[model samples]
Target: MRIFLLFFPVFFFCGLLHAQTVKVEYGGDPLPDKDRKKIEQFLQHEVDFYSQFGLPDTLSLQLYVFENRREAIDYLESINVSLPIKASGAYSPKLQKAVILGRENGRERSLAIIYHELSHHFVSQILGKRPPSWLNEGLSEYFEHCTIHKKAVRHTFTEYEQGRVRTMYMLGEVNLPTFLK
Candidate 1:
């Protein structure tokens, strides 16, 4: 009876986590309703993908979108986060939030940035800890190119990635086991 009582809450909590809805909130500069809807759809797709592995019960995601890099930097400063000039987006694992420079780039590019940052967010949730930097960034980058459809999902490498792989192959540095280690 004591064992059943001890284990019951664990099972109940796991079930609740599996059934929980992912709530998304927006902040910073306001976005158009159309854009917001699109982002929500994309995030829902990611949420569905991550759900298979399990998620926290309080899986709320906050996205802060700024009109340009300057605004993005300013918001980051307000939050005491130093912005890197080259970064198009950032994810704060501590806050379960993503910050992005929106509209400066085309729609596709902006979506890719969201994809990358949200990948980081979801990965953090599933692992319950930050993954190694290389693996974290690699997975995020991979998801940045993913095309998720109702019936299918596909991913492709960028030209830069293709060239990098080719160079690595030429240099004979393409050892999978070594890279994994």
Candidate 2:
């Protein structure tokens, strides 16, 4: 009877946890509906842009827009990642999320940051949470640049050849054992 009573609350609490909806807050400049619509359009463009690289279609993405760097830092602090930049924007793969901090005063800058973060999101999804650190960071940088230039392949290969960036070989072996380590 004591065992059953102890287990009852555990099961009840688990049920309640599963039934909860996740609420996300976006801090920054308040985006008007019209601007938000434009942002969505830019996101779609990024999607198409990344698709050219043979990225999988199963990856899902969400974007949160913040008004400025301070608000972004505040929100990021809540999630426990260090803020290393004045950051026009940032991405969080664990949350399956990207955040754009600051307004789209212009299309080019806004779209660039969005595409960069979206690239990170997709890479995280494709690698199934066990990709190599170098590959992960390199791919994210590659996609960020590609989004900026609308290129199919960016400077990654060249950068690797020139020693400007670490090669996949130096990134360690591409096996699960090496990668997960």
- Residue 166, model 1, lDDT: 76
Model 2 lDDT on a 0 to 1 scale = 0.52
Error of 2 at 9 (Å): 39
TM-score (all chains, Cα) for each model: 0.72, 0.50
What candidate 2 gets wrong by more than 4 Å, as runs, is 1-59, 104-107, 146-181
Please report the candidate that would top TM-score against the real structure: 1
Candidate 2 lDDT tens digits, 41-78: 44454445445554453444556666555676676787
Question: Candidate 1's residue-wise lDDT over 115-179, tens digit each?
Answer: 89888998899886677888789878888997656665567778997899779977998975675
At residue 130, what lDDT does model 1 achieve? Answer: 72
